[model samples]
Target: MTDSTIWWVLAGLVVGAELLTGTFYLLMVSAGLIGAAIAAHLGVSLPFQIAVAALLGGGLSVALRFYRKAAAAKNPLSKTDGNLDVGARVMVDAWATDGTAQVKYRGANWVAMPVTGETPTPGMHQIEEVVGSRLLIKKL
Candidate 1:
Protein backbone atom coordinates (compact mmCIF):
# COMPACT_ATOMS: atom_id res chain seq x y z
CA MET A 1 0.00 0.00 0.00
CA THR A 2 1.07 3.65 -0.37
CA ASP A 3 2.99 5.34 2.50
CA SER A 4 0.32 7.95 3.14
CA THR A 5 -2.40 5.28 3.14
CA ILE A 6 -0.45 3.20 5.62
CA TRP A 7 -0.05 6.19 7.94
CA TRP A 8 -3.75 6.94 7.76
CA VAL A 9 -4.61 3.32 8.58
CA LEU A 10 -2.25 3.34 11.54
CA ALA A 11 -3.82 6.52 12.83
CA GLY A 12 -7.27 4.99 12.52
CA LEU A 13 -6.20 1.92 14.45
CA VAL A 14 -4.74 4.06 17.21
CA VAL A 15 -7.99 5.97 17.45
CA GLY A 16 -9.92 2.73 17.75
CA ALA A 17 -7.58 1.49 20.47
CA GLU A 18 -7.97 4.75 22.36
CA LEU A 19 -11.72 4.31 22.29
CA LEU A 20 -11.49 0.82 23.75
CA THR A 21 -8.99 1.81 26.45
CA GLY A 22 -10.68 5.12 27.34
CA THR A 23 -7.31 6.79 27.74
CA PHE A 24 -6.78 10.36 26.57
CA TYR A 25 -3.07 9.88 25.81
CA LEU A 26 -3.69 7.47 22.95
CA LEU A 27 -5.87 10.07 21.26
CA MET A 28 -2.91 12.42 21.35
CA VAL A 29 -0.74 9.81 19.65
CA SER A 30 -3.40 9.28 17.01
CA ALA A 31 -3.31 12.99 16.27
CA GLY A 32 0.44 12.70 15.75
CA LEU A 33 0.00 9.78 13.35
CA ILE A 34 -2.43 11.89 11.36
CA GLY A 35 0.24 14.58 11.13
CA ALA A 36 2.68 12.01 9.81
CA ALA A 37 0.12 10.98 7.20
CA ILE A 38 -0.14 14.58 6.03
CA ALA A 39 3.65 14.78 5.74
CA ALA A 40 3.70 11.58 3.71
CA HIS A 41 1.02 12.97 1.39
CA LEU A 42 3.28 16.03 0.85
CA GLY A 43 6.05 13.73 -0.42
CA VAL A 44 8.25 14.05 2.65
CA SER A 45 11.04 11.51 3.23
CA LEU A 46 10.29 8.48 5.45
CA PRO A 47 12.66 9.72 8.17
CA PHE A 48 11.03 13.14 8.16
CA GLN A 49 7.58 11.58 8.35
CA ILE A 50 8.66 9.50 11.33
CA ALA A 51 10.04 12.62 12.99
CA VAL A 52 6.75 14.41 12.52
CA ALA A 53 4.84 11.52 14.13
CA ALA A 54 7.21 11.28 17.11
CA LEU A 55 7.24 15.02 17.70
CA LEU A 56 3.48 15.45 17.47
CA GLY A 57 2.61 12.36 19.51
CA GLY A 58 5.15 12.90 22.30
CA GLY A 59 4.63 16.66 22.42
CA LEU A 60 0.84 16.34 22.66
CA SER A 61 1.08 13.70 25.41
CA VAL A 62 3.47 15.84 27.42
CA ALA A 63 1.22 18.85 26.98
CA LEU A 64 -1.81 16.85 28.12
CA ARG A 65 0.06 15.62 31.20
CA PHE A 66 1.01 19.15 32.14
CA TYR A 67 -2.50 20.39 31.57
CA ARG A 68 -3.98 17.68 33.82
CA LYS A 69 -1.44 18.47 36.53
CA ALA A 70 -2.27 22.16 36.39
CA ALA A 71 -5.98 21.40 36.59
CA ALA A 72 -5.44 19.14 39.62
CA ALA A 73 -3.35 21.82 41.32
CA LYS A 74 -6.08 24.42 40.87
CA ASN A 75 -8.54 22.05 42.58
CA PRO A 76 -6.88 19.53 44.85
CA LEU A 77 -9.90 17.24 44.91
CA SER A 78 -9.91 17.04 41.10
CA LYS A 79 -7.60 14.07 41.34
CA THR A 80 -10.46 12.08 42.79
CA ASP A 81 -12.61 12.67 39.73
CA GLY A 82 -13.10 8.96 39.19
CA ASN A 83 -14.39 8.33 42.69
CA LEU A 84 -18.18 8.18 42.82
CA ASP A 85 -18.36 9.22 46.48
CA VAL A 86 -16.57 12.49 45.97
CA GLY A 87 -18.92 15.42 46.72
CA ALA A 88 -21.38 13.00 48.33
CA ARG A 89 -22.48 13.88 51.86
CA VAL A 90 -21.84 11.74 54.90
CA MET A 91 -22.80 12.03 58.56
CA VAL A 92 -20.09 12.42 61.16
CA ASP A 93 -21.47 11.65 64.59
CA ALA A 94 -18.36 12.68 66.49
CA TRP A 95 -14.69 13.61 66.07
CA ALA A 96 -11.82 11.96 67.91
CA THR A 97 -8.76 13.60 69.43
CA ASP A 98 -6.66 12.71 66.36
CA GLY A 99 -9.16 14.61 64.18
CA THR A 100 -10.63 11.51 62.53
CA ALA A 101 -14.10 10.12 62.90
CA GLN A 102 -15.90 6.81 62.48
CA VAL A 103 -18.48 7.97 59.97
CA LYS A 104 -21.20 6.04 58.22
CA TYR A 105 -21.03 6.52 54.46
CA ARG A 106 -22.64 4.44 51.72
CA GLY A 107 -24.23 2.26 54.39
CA ALA A 108 -20.92 1.26 55.96
CA ASN A 109 -18.37 2.48 58.47
CA TRP A 110 -15.66 4.69 56.99
CA VAL A 111 -12.70 6.38 58.65
CA ALA A 112 -13.19 10.01 57.69
CA MET A 113 -10.66 12.79 58.17
CA PRO A 114 -10.63 16.46 57.31
CA VAL A 115 -8.97 18.04 54.29
CA THR A 116 -5.85 20.14 54.71
CA GLY A 117 -6.09 23.27 56.93
CA GLU A 118 -9.50 22.41 58.39
CA THR A 119 -10.57 21.50 61.89
CA PRO A 120 -12.61 18.32 62.07
CA THR A 121 -16.00 19.06 63.51
CA PRO A 122 -18.91 16.76 64.13
CA GLY A 123 -21.82 17.29 61.76
CA MET A 124 -22.39 16.77 58.02
CA HIS A 125 -19.29 16.36 55.81
CA GLN A 126 -18.61 15.77 52.16
CA ILE A 127 -16.19 13.31 50.66
CA GLU A 128 -13.23 15.14 49.12
CA GLU A 129 -10.86 12.28 48.35
CA VAL A 130 -10.57 8.62 49.13
CA VAL A 131 -7.03 7.56 49.97
CA GLY A 132 -6.96 3.85 50.58
CA SER A 133 -9.63 3.04 53.16
CA ARG A 134 -9.61 6.55 54.55
CA LEU A 135 -11.93 9.27 53.30
CA LEU A 136 -10.63 12.83 53.28
CA ILE A 137 -13.73 14.80 54.20
CA LYS A 138 -14.69 18.46 54.16
CA LYS A 139 -17.03 19.93 56.78
CA LEU A 140 -20.15 21.32 55.16
Candidate 2:
Protein backbone atom coordinates (compact mmCIF):
# COMPACT_ATOMS: atom_id res chain seq x y z
CA MET A 1 0.00 0.00 0.00
CA THR A 2 1.60 3.24 1.21
CA ASP A 3 5.35 3.69 1.62
CA SER A 4 4.97 4.04 5.39
CA THR A 5 2.93 0.86 5.54
CA ILE A 6 5.57 -0.97 3.53
CA TRP A 7 8.24 0.27 5.92
CA TRP A 8 6.27 -0.97 8.91
CA VAL A 9 5.82 -4.35 7.31
CA LEU A 10 9.52 -4.55 6.63
CA ALA A 11 10.21 -3.62 10.23
CA GLY A 12 7.96 -6.42 11.41
CA LEU A 13 9.78 -8.84 9.14
CA VAL A 14 13.13 -7.66 10.51
CA VAL A 15 12.05 -8.19 14.09
CA GLY A 16 10.74 -11.66 13.21
CA ALA A 17 13.98 -12.56 11.50
CA GLU A 18 15.97 -11.27 14.44
CA LEU A 19 13.99 -13.50 16.77
CA LEU A 20 14.76 -16.51 14.63
CA THR A 21 18.42 -15.61 14.25
CA GLY A 22 18.79 -14.74 17.94
CA THR A 23 21.05 -11.79 17.13
CA PHE A 24 20.64 -8.05 17.55
CA TYR A 25 21.57 -7.29 13.95
CA LEU A 26 18.05 -7.63 12.56
CA LEU A 27 16.69 -5.75 15.53
CA MET A 28 18.78 -2.81 14.40
CA VAL A 29 17.25 -3.06 10.92
CA SER A 30 13.82 -3.03 12.51
CA ALA A 31 14.85 0.09 14.36
CA GLY A 32 15.97 1.58 11.07
CA LEU A 33 12.59 0.77 9.60
CA ILE A 34 10.98 2.58 12.49
CA GLY A 35 13.20 5.58 11.81
CA ALA A 36 12.20 5.50 8.17
CA ALA A 37 8.55 5.32 9.09
CA ILE A 38 8.95 8.25 11.41
CA ALA A 39 10.68 10.27 8.74
CA ALA A 40 7.96 9.40 6.26
CA HIS A 41 5.28 10.39 8.72
CA LEU A 42 7.10 13.72 9.06
CA GLY A 43 6.51 14.24 5.30
CA VAL A 44 10.15 13.79 4.40
CA SER A 45 11.22 12.78 0.89
CA LEU A 46 11.35 9.04 0.22
CA PRO A 47 15.08 9.01 -0.49
CA PHE A 48 15.92 11.03 2.61
CA GLN A 49 13.74 8.85 4.79
CA ILE A 50 15.37 5.69 3.52
CA ALA A 51 18.80 7.21 4.00
CA VAL A 52 18.06 8.20 7.55
CA ALA A 53 16.76 4.76 8.32
CA ALA A 54 19.77 3.05 6.76
CA LEU A 55 22.23 5.28 8.58
CA LEU A 56 20.57 5.05 11.96
CA GLY A 57 19.85 1.34 11.91
CA GLY A 58 22.97 0.14 10.12
CA GLY A 59 25.20 2.44 12.13
CA LEU A 60 23.80 1.17 15.42
CA SER A 61 24.20 -2.46 14.36
CA VAL A 62 27.82 -1.94 13.36
CA ALA A 63 28.61 -0.06 16.54
CA LEU A 64 27.09 -2.77 18.68
CA ARG A 65 29.00 -5.50 16.85
CA PHE A 66 32.24 -3.59 17.25
CA TYR A 67 31.62 -3.07 20.95
CA ARG A 68 30.85 -6.74 21.46
CA LYS A 69 33.98 -7.82 19.62
CA ALA A 70 36.14 -5.41 21.58
CA ALA A 71 34.71 -6.48 24.91
CA ALA A 72 35.07 -10.16 24.07
CA ALA A 73 38.63 -9.66 22.92
CA LYS A 74 39.42 -7.70 26.06
CA ASN A 75 38.03 -10.48 28.21
CA PRO A 76 38.10 -13.98 26.86
CA LEU A 77 35.85 -15.24 29.66
CA SER A 78 33.13 -12.75 28.81
CA LYS A 79 31.06 -15.56 27.31
CA THR A 80 32.65 -18.62 28.81
CA ASP A 81 32.94 -19.86 32.39
CA GLY A 82 34.36 -16.74 34.00
CA ASN A 83 33.44 -17.32 37.59
CA LEU A 84 33.40 -21.10 37.49
CA ASP A 85 36.81 -22.66 38.12
CA VAL A 86 38.48 -19.43 37.20
CA GLY A 87 41.60 -18.82 39.27
CA ALA A 88 40.88 -22.13 40.93
CA ARG A 89 43.32 -24.99 41.42
CA VAL A 90 43.06 -28.21 39.45
CA MET A 91 45.10 -31.32 38.75
CA VAL A 92 47.19 -31.80 35.66
CA ASP A 93 46.58 -34.93 33.64
CA ALA A 94 49.28 -34.42 31.06
CA TRP A 95 52.55 -32.61 30.28
CA ALA A 96 53.41 -29.57 28.21
CA THR A 97 54.98 -29.44 24.79
CA ASP A 98 55.02 -26.21 22.76
CA GLY A 99 52.84 -24.53 25.42
CA THR A 100 50.07 -27.13 25.42
CA ALA A 101 49.00 -29.69 28.00
CA GLN A 102 45.99 -31.41 29.52
CA VAL A 103 44.55 -30.98 32.98
CA LYS A 104 41.70 -32.42 35.03
CA TYR A 105 39.55 -29.92 36.85
CA ARG A 106 36.18 -30.19 38.57
CA GLY A 107 36.00 -33.84 37.51
CA ALA A 108 36.41 -32.84 33.85
CA ASN A 109 39.44 -33.32 31.69
CA TRP A 110 40.53 -30.09 30.02
CA VAL A 111 43.41 -29.42 27.70
CA ALA A 112 45.69 -26.83 29.28
CA MET A 113 48.86 -24.98 28.32
CA PRO A 114 51.33 -22.80 30.12
CA VAL A 115 51.09 -19.23 29.21
CA THR A 116 54.31 -18.15 30.99
CA GLY A 117 56.15 -21.12 32.52
CA GLU A 118 56.70 -24.86 32.29
CA THR A 119 53.83 -27.33 32.05
CA PRO A 120 52.51 -28.83 35.24
CA THR A 121 52.85 -32.51 35.90
CA PRO A 122 49.97 -34.85 36.72
CA GLY A 123 48.78 -33.69 40.16
CA MET A 124 47.90 -30.37 41.73
CA HIS A 125 47.92 -27.42 39.35
CA GLN A 126 46.36 -23.99 39.23
CA ILE A 127 44.15 -22.57 36.54
CA GLU A 128 45.69 -19.36 35.25
CA GLU A 129 43.66 -18.37 32.24
CA VAL A 130 41.09 -19.94 29.97
CA VAL A 131 40.96 -19.21 26.28
CA GLY A 132 38.17 -20.97 24.51
CA SER A 133 38.24 -24.64 25.54
CA ARG A 134 41.88 -24.54 26.58
CA LEU A 135 43.06 -23.53 30.01
CA LEU A 136 46.36 -21.78 30.66
CA ILE A 137 47.71 -23.30 33.79
CA LYS A 138 50.61 -23.05 36.28
CA LYS A 139 51.99 -25.48 38.82
CA LEU A 140 50.46 -25.05 42.24
Candidate 3:
Protein backbone atom coordinates (compact mmCIF):
# COMPACT_ATOMS: atom_id res chain seq x y z
CA MET A 1 0.00 0.00 0.00
CA THR A 2 1.07 3.63 -0.49
CA ASP A 3 2.48 5.70 2.42
CA SER A 4 -0.54 8.00 2.54
CA THR A 5 -2.94 5.08 2.53
CA ILE A 6 -1.02 3.50 5.41
CA TRP A 7 -1.30 6.70 7.46
CA TRP A 8 -5.02 6.90 6.79
CA VAL A 9 -5.47 3.33 7.96
CA LEU A 10 -3.59 4.09 11.17
CA ALA A 11 -5.77 7.11 11.73
CA GLY A 12 -8.93 5.05 11.28
CA LEU A 13 -7.72 2.43 13.71
CA VAL A 14 -6.88 5.07 16.34
CA VAL A 15 -10.30 6.65 15.91
CA GLY A 16 -12.00 3.27 16.34
CA ALA A 17 -10.01 2.64 19.51
CA GLU A 18 -11.01 6.03 20.82
CA LEU A 19 -14.66 5.12 20.35
CA LEU A 20 -14.27 1.95 22.37
CA THR A 21 -12.29 3.63 25.15
CA GLY A 22 -14.54 6.69 25.37
CA THR A 23 -11.49 8.90 25.60
CA PHE A 24 -11.40 12.00 23.38
CA TYR A 25 -7.62 12.12 23.70
CA LEU A 26 -7.29 9.22 21.28
CA LEU A 27 -9.39 11.10 18.75
CA MET A 28 -6.99 14.03 19.07
CA VAL A 29 -4.07 11.79 18.23
CA SER A 30 -6.00 10.45 15.27
CA ALA A 31 -6.25 14.01 13.97
CA GLY A 32 -2.45 14.10 13.92
CA LEU A 33 -2.35 10.86 12.02
CA ILE A 34 -4.73 12.35 9.48
CA GLY A 35 -2.45 15.37 9.18
CA ALA A 36 0.48 13.09 8.49
CA ALA A 37 -1.57 11.33 5.84
CA ILE A 38 -2.28 14.66 4.19
CA ALA A 39 1.45 15.51 4.24
CA ALA A 40 2.27 12.17 2.66
CA HIS A 41 -0.35 12.75 -0.04
CA LEU A 42 1.42 16.06 -0.73
CA GLY A 43 4.73 14.17 -1.23
CA VAL A 44 6.37 15.65 1.89
CA SER A 45 9.47 13.98 3.39
CA LEU A 46 8.93 11.25 5.98
CA PRO A 47 10.41 13.37 8.81
CA PHE A 48 8.11 16.31 8.01
CA GLN A 49 5.08 14.07 7.88
CA ILE A 50 5.92 12.60 11.26
CA ALA A 51 6.46 16.08 12.71
CA VAL A 52 3.07 17.28 11.43
CA ALA A 53 1.30 14.30 12.93
CA ALA A 54 3.06 14.59 16.27
CA LEU A 55 2.42 18.32 16.60
CA LEU A 56 -1.26 18.07 15.70
CA GLY A 57 -1.91 15.15 18.06
CA GLY A 58 0.02 16.64 21.00
CA GLY A 59 -1.55 20.07 20.66
CA LEU A 60 -5.07 18.72 20.42
CA SER A 61 -4.59 16.43 23.43
CA VAL A 62 -3.35 19.34 25.56
CA ALA A 63 -6.28 21.52 24.47
CA LEU A 64 -8.77 18.79 25.31
CA ARG A 65 -7.25 18.35 28.76
CA PHE A 66 -7.63 22.04 29.50
CA TYR A 67 -11.22 22.01 28.26
CA ARG A 68 -12.19 19.06 30.47
CA LYS A 69 -10.62 20.71 33.52
CA ALA A 70 -12.50 23.93 32.88
CA ALA A 71 -15.78 22.06 32.42
CA ALA A 72 -15.29 20.14 35.68
CA ALA A 73 -14.60 23.38 37.55
CA LYS A 74 -17.76 24.94 36.16
CA ASN A 75 -19.99 21.99 37.08
CA PRO A 76 -18.53 20.21 40.06
CA LEU A 77 -21.86 18.75 41.12
CA SER A 78 -22.98 17.48 37.74
CA LYS A 79 -22.15 13.84 38.41
CA THR A 80 -23.92 13.82 41.75
CA ASP A 81 -27.37 14.05 40.20
CA GLY A 82 -26.90 10.90 38.19
CA ASN A 83 -26.71 8.81 41.37
CA LEU A 84 -30.47 8.92 41.91
CA ASP A 85 -29.76 10.32 45.37
CA VAL A 86 -28.82 13.93 44.97
CA GLY A 87 -31.90 16.19 44.85
CA ALA A 88 -33.99 13.46 46.46
CA ARG A 89 -35.87 14.48 49.57
CA VAL A 90 -35.42 12.56 52.80
CA MET A 91 -36.82 12.68 56.33
CA VAL A 92 -34.27 13.44 59.03
CA ASP A 93 -35.47 11.98 62.30
CA ALA A 94 -32.70 13.63 64.30
CA TRP A 95 -29.31 15.35 64.05
CA ALA A 96 -26.08 15.23 66.07
CA THR A 97 -24.39 18.20 67.68
CA ASP A 98 -22.04 18.58 64.70
CA GLY A 99 -24.99 18.88 62.27
CA THR A 100 -24.68 15.31 61.07
CA ALA A 101 -26.98 12.29 61.17
CA GLN A 102 -27.84 8.95 59.64
CA VAL A 103 -30.91 9.16 57.47
CA LYS A 104 -32.77 6.64 55.37
CA TYR A 105 -32.42 7.53 51.69
CA ARG A 106 -33.25 5.53 48.58
CA GLY A 107 -34.04 2.50 50.79
CA ALA A 108 -30.59 2.71 52.40
CA ASN A 109 -29.12 4.40 55.47
CA TRP A 110 -26.82 7.27 54.51
CA VAL A 111 -24.65 9.57 56.59
CA ALA A 112 -25.98 13.08 56.10
CA MET A 113 -24.59 16.48 56.92
CA PRO A 114 -25.83 20.04 56.59
CA VAL A 115 -24.48 22.03 53.66
CA THR A 116 -24.41 25.34 55.56
CA GLY A 117 -23.39 26.37 59.08
CA GLU A 118 -27.03 26.57 60.20
CA THR A 119 -28.21 23.48 62.06
CA PRO A 120 -30.95 21.47 60.42
CA THR A 121 -33.98 20.34 62.43
CA PRO A 122 -35.64 16.97 62.39
CA GLY A 123 -37.95 17.29 59.40
CA MET A 124 -37.91 17.15 55.62
CA HIS A 125 -34.47 17.57 54.06
CA GLN A 126 -33.32 17.73 50.47
CA ILE A 127 -30.21 16.04 49.21
CA GLU A 128 -28.13 18.87 47.80
CA GLU A 129 -25.05 16.84 46.90
CA VAL A 130 -23.44 13.43 47.28
CA VAL A 131 -19.83 13.22 48.30
CA GLY A 132 -18.67 9.63 48.04
CA SER A 133 -21.05 7.64 50.21
CA ARG A 134 -22.11 10.67 52.27
CA LEU A 135 -24.85 13.17 51.49
CA LEU A 136 -24.73 16.94 51.89
CA ILE A 137 -28.24 17.97 52.87
CA LYS A 138 -30.29 21.14 53.20
CA LYS A 139 -33.57 21.91 54.91
CA LEU A 140 -36.49 21.57 52.58
Candidate 4:
Protein backbone atom coordinates (compact mmCIF):
# COMPACT_ATOMS: atom_id res chain seq x y z
CA MET A 1 0.00 0.00 0.00
CA THR A 2 2.85 2.39 0.83
CA ASP A 3 5.24 3.73 -1.82
CA SER A 4 8.18 1.98 -0.18
CA THR A 5 6.29 -1.29 -0.17
CA ILE A 6 5.62 -0.97 -3.91
CA TRP A 7 9.29 -0.35 -4.62
CA TRP A 8 10.27 -3.30 -2.49
CA VAL A 9 7.88 -5.51 -4.47
CA LEU A 10 9.40 -4.36 -7.74
CA ALA A 11 12.85 -5.13 -6.50
CA GLY A 12 11.76 -8.57 -5.36
CA LEU A 13 10.26 -9.28 -8.77
CA VAL A 14 13.45 -8.27 -10.55
CA VAL A 15 15.49 -10.51 -8.27
CA GLY A 16 13.14 -13.42 -8.92
CA ALA A 17 13.40 -12.92 -12.66
CA GLU A 18 17.16 -12.74 -12.45
CA LEU A 19 17.17 -16.04 -10.59
CA LEU A 20 15.05 -17.73 -13.24
CA THR A 21 16.98 -16.41 -16.25
CA GLY A 22 20.39 -16.22 -14.57
CA THR A 23 20.85 -12.75 -16.09
CA PHE A 24 23.14 -10.50 -14.12
CA TYR A 25 21.78 -7.27 -15.54
CA LEU A 26 18.53 -7.55 -13.63
CA LEU A 27 20.39 -7.38 -10.34
CA MET A 28 21.48 -3.86 -11.17
CA VAL A 29 17.89 -2.79 -11.60
CA SER A 30 16.99 -4.48 -8.38
CA ALA A 31 19.59 -2.42 -6.59
CA GLY A 32 18.00 0.72 -7.99
CA LEU A 33 14.58 -0.38 -6.87
CA ILE A 34 15.91 -0.94 -3.39
CA GLY A 35 17.41 2.54 -3.45
CA ALA A 36 14.05 3.99 -4.47
CA ALA A 37 12.38 2.11 -1.63
CA ILE A 38 14.80 3.65 0.81
CA ALA A 39 14.14 7.05 -0.66
CA ALA A 40 10.40 6.56 -0.32
CA HIS A 41 10.74 5.55 3.29
CA LEU A 42 12.68 8.78 3.86
CA GLY A 43 9.59 10.79 2.83
CA VAL A 44 11.13 12.02 -0.40
CA SER A 45 8.82 13.30 -3.14
CA LEU A 46 7.62 10.83 -5.76
CA PRO A 47 9.65 12.59 -8.47
CA PHE A 48 12.82 12.40 -6.42
CA GLN A 49 12.21 8.74 -5.73
CA ILE A 50 11.76 8.06 -9.42
CA ALA A 51 14.99 9.89 -10.20
CA VAL A 52 16.86 7.96 -7.57
CA ALA A 53 15.65 4.66 -8.99
CA ALA A 54 16.49 5.57 -12.56
CA LEU A 55 19.94 6.95 -11.78
CA LEU A 56 20.94 4.02 -9.61
CA GLY A 57 19.68 1.38 -12.01
CA GLY A 58 20.97 2.99 -15.22
CA GLY A 59 24.36 3.77 -13.76
CA LEU A 60 24.81 0.27 -12.43
CA SER A 61 23.77 -1.31 -15.73
CA VAL A 62 26.21 0.77 -17.75
CA ALA A 63 28.96 0.06 -15.26
CA LEU A 64 28.39 -3.67 -15.42
CA ARG A 65 28.37 -3.64 -19.24
CA PHE A 66 31.68 -1.81 -19.43
CA TYR A 67 33.16 -4.08 -16.78
CA ARG A 68 32.21 -7.17 -18.76
CA LYS A 69 33.67 -5.70 -21.95
CA ALA A 70 36.95 -4.88 -20.28
CA ALA A 71 37.19 -8.33 -18.70
CA ALA A 72 36.53 -10.00 -22.07
CA ALA A 73 39.16 -7.87 -23.76
CA LYS A 74 41.70 -8.90 -21.18
CA ASN A 75 40.95 -12.58 -21.52
CA PRO A 76 42.93 -14.31 -24.27
CA LEU A 77 41.81 -17.34 -26.19
CA SER A 78 44.33 -19.44 -24.32
CA LYS A 79 42.91 -19.41 -20.82
CA THR A 80 45.45 -20.14 -18.13
CA ASP A 81 43.13 -22.48 -16.28
CA GLY A 82 42.09 -24.55 -19.29
CA ASN A 83 45.31 -24.81 -21.29
CA LEU A 84 48.47 -26.48 -20.06
CA ASP A 85 50.55 -25.45 -23.07
CA VAL A 86 50.82 -21.93 -21.82
CA GLY A 87 54.10 -21.23 -20.00
CA ALA A 88 55.68 -24.32 -21.53
CA ARG A 89 59.10 -23.84 -23.11
CA VAL A 90 60.21 -24.85 -26.59
CA MET A 91 63.27 -24.35 -28.78
CA VAL A 92 63.21 -22.24 -31.91
CA ASP A 93 65.90 -23.13 -34.40
CA ALA A 94 65.16 -20.31 -36.85
CA TRP A 95 62.76 -17.50 -37.59
CA ALA A 96 61.25 -17.00 -41.03
CA THR A 97 61.45 -13.75 -42.98
CA ASP A 98 57.83 -12.98 -42.05
CA GLY A 99 58.74 -12.94 -38.34
CA THR A 100 57.15 -16.27 -37.61
CA ALA A 101 58.78 -19.48 -36.49
CA GLN A 102 58.05 -23.19 -36.78
CA VAL A 103 58.97 -25.11 -33.65
CA LYS A 104 58.59 -28.70 -32.67
CA TYR A 105 56.56 -28.85 -29.45
CA ARG A 106 54.62 -31.77 -28.04
CA GLY A 107 55.83 -34.02 -30.86
CA ALA A 108 54.35 -31.76 -33.56
CA ASN A 109 55.34 -28.65 -35.47
CA TRP A 110 53.60 -25.48 -34.34
CA VAL A 111 53.57 -22.00 -35.82
CA ALA A 112 54.60 -19.34 -33.36
CA MET A 113 54.73 -15.58 -33.35
CA PRO A 114 56.79 -13.37 -31.10
CA VAL A 115 55.04 -11.76 -28.17
CA THR A 116 54.29 -8.12 -28.62
CA GLY A 117 57.13 -5.76 -27.58
CA GLU A 118 59.65 -8.58 -27.98
CA THR A 119 62.09 -9.14 -30.79
CA PRO A 120 61.85 -12.41 -32.68
CA THR A 121 65.03 -14.45 -32.40
CA PRO A 122 65.93 -18.11 -32.63
CA GLY A 123 66.44 -19.62 -29.20
CA MET A 124 64.48 -21.09 -26.30
CA HIS A 125 61.02 -19.46 -26.00
CA GLN A 126 58.09 -19.75 -23.66
CA ILE A 127 54.49 -20.07 -24.82
CA GLU A 128 52.89 -16.92 -23.47
CA GLU A 129 49.55 -17.26 -25.12
CA VAL A 130 47.70 -19.44 -27.62
CA VAL A 131 45.26 -18.16 -30.19
CA GLY A 132 43.66 -21.11 -31.89
CA SER A 133 46.56 -23.14 -33.30
CA ARG A 134 48.99 -20.22 -33.25
CA LEU A 135 51.32 -19.79 -30.28
CA LEU A 136 52.55 -16.50 -28.93
CA ILE A 137 56.10 -16.96 -27.76
CA LYS A 138 58.41 -14.79 -25.73
CA LYS A 139 62.16 -15.16 -25.32
CA LEU A 140 63.09 -16.91 -22.10
For all predicted structures, in order, the TM-scores are 0.62, 0.64, 0.69, 0.57
Count of residue pairs whose backbone atoms collide, per candidate: 0, 0, 0, 0
Residue runs of model 4 more than 4 Å from their true location after superposition: 78-140
Show model 3 residue runs off by greater than 4 Å: 78-84, 92-121, 128-140
Q: Please give, for residues 1-140, the per-residue lDDT of candidate 4 as tens digits.
A: 99999999999999999999999999999999999999999999999999999999999999999999999789855457668899999999999999999999999999999989989988999998889899999999
Worst 10 residues of 2 by lDDT: 77-86
For model 2, the superposed segments whose C-alpha errors exceed 4 Å read 78-87, 91-123, 127-137
Q: How displaced is residue 101 in candidate 2, in Å?
A: 12
Best by lDDT: 4
Of the candidates shown, which would achieve the greatest TM-score relative to the real structure?
Answer: 3
Per-residue CA lDDT of model 1 for 58-79, tens digit only, reads: 9999999999999978877455
- For model 3 the local lDDT of residue 72 reads 80
Model 3 global lDDT (CA atoms, 0 to 1): 0.90
lDDT of all the models against the reference?
A: 0.92, 0.80, 0.90, 0.94
Which TM-score value belongs to model 3? Answer: 0.69
Ranking by lDDT: 4, 1, 3, 2
Candidate 2 residue-wise lDDT, 16-74, digit = tens:
99989998888988999999998888889999988988998999899989999999888
Better of 2 and 4 by lDDT: 4
